[model samples]
Target chain A: MSNAAFVIIAIFTLAAALAAATLRKLMHAALSFAVALVGLAALFFLLGAEFVGLALVFIYIGAVAVLIVFTILLTRRDVGKDRGFNWAGVLIALAVFCGLTWSILKTQSLSIVAPHIRALTVKRIGEALMTGYVWPLQCVGLLLTAALIGALILVMEEKR
Target chain B: MTPTLQAFVLVSGALFSIGLLAALSRRHAIFILIGIELMLAAANLNFIAFWHFAPQPHQPTGVMFAIFSIAISAAEAAIGLAMVIAVYRHYHTTNVDQLDQLKG
Candidate 1:
């Protein structure tokens, strides 16, 4: 049932994330990251966070991933051949993974009874945004506006 | 039955590690940005998972936090890419290891 689906999506997410990190080609890594993000969004949906899941797809897949691909295309040039693999980086990442996995397994505080999931509809989210969380919601709007202007300024060509 | 919270937390930890590897090892600035995005998603996954499984399910605390985080991260991505573009234009290169003029 749902557990099977979760396992499948979780496996896909980890595999895609691994590829995204390990792939040499920038474009391939970006695509793999997109796959990983999509898998995460699916997991969100399966976890009953429907609005956040859809927003993940909309924002990450639709926006951030595409932006990464565009940047890769723009920055493309014939650099020297890839230096194969960086063993030091691999060792560092492996160490971090092993330590984190061990600590996560050893920690007992995370155990909790799984509460029954209630459907989180978009209307409820919108209402929450407009009510209790209104202040942060407005702050987010301001942040986005500032980011847009700043990006334009940064990328704009200077006059001779 | 639903997947346990422990399962979700483990997956997030694994994803965070993968992103850390990419950010640390990759020379390309774009790859670093992609890694950062992966890391942000992992953190967001934790927030959503805890929110979903918390004993008090009546509140939308996790959902609101995740939404704000996602929105802000989108802004971060935009600003990061803009900086990447500026760097590429200035140095004629996007490799982090080569841009060492800042080293004292």
Candidate 2:
């Protein structure tokens, strides 16, 4: 059943997220973050947003995770350094979870099941991106270009 | 059978809180960025869930939003990690706890 699959993926994601939050080793934590993203993509697939799911896997796991690992490798004086964490932050995260869960449970409107709708294919997404969302897509492209140049400028060696 | 909308929301909430924990608690700058990425993904999950559960799920608004969001987040991660590397070049340390000086 899909419910069982959802449960499994949810548990896997949560567990990997927790590991990423708590792991002492930086590389391990980054890898765990990738795993968590994969599980999230699985949840997206289960929700029937297949294109987004694939994008999630491709971007987060393929691009973002590798980028993080490379950044870690590049900016390193100590690879085996101890990653100290603040217990107060953990307490705050728990408090946030409690508040969110309480509000979600108290709201009766969120109990509805998913509607039977036509599949959201990649073609439809492409069509919308070309038609109604074209401007935003172009803006995003420009933003990405600006980000690339800005990042390069930021990390450029200062001429002494 | 498919789970209810609340179920998906709850999972998203849990992932978000975990991300908050990572972003707030971690000592390394890259770890903080990773946490922020997780938080963004959690929001994307919520958007997709709502789009799926809508009364009339005709528009592909949520999927479009998620795609754009992912794009923006990628840019953000690139810029943030670049900042991390630049700061490391100057300070020679990746731990945020030690980078206390305001003006380098």
List of chain B TM-scores, one per candidate? 0.97, 0.95
Which whole-number lDDT from 0 to 100 does residue A9 have in model 1?
Answer: 96
lDDT of 2 by residue, B41-96 (tens): 99999999999999878799999999999999999999999999998899888888
Docking class for candidate 2: high
Q: How does chain A of every candidate compare to the true chain A by TM-score?
A: 0.90, 0.96
TM-score for the first chain in candidate 1 comes to 0.90
User: Scored by CA lDDT, what does every candidate get?
Assistant: 0.87, 0.91
In model 1 chain A, the worst 10-residue window by lDDT is: A78-87
Q: State what share of the real interface contacts each candidate retains.
A: 0.71, 0.87
DockQ of each: 0.71, 0.83
At residue A93, candidate 1 shows an lDDT of 84
Q: Write the residue-wise lDDT of candidate 1 on A21-133 in tens digits.
A: 88888888889999999999999887788889989999999999999888887878723434445668878988988998898888887765477666777888889999988
* lDDT value for model 1: 0.87
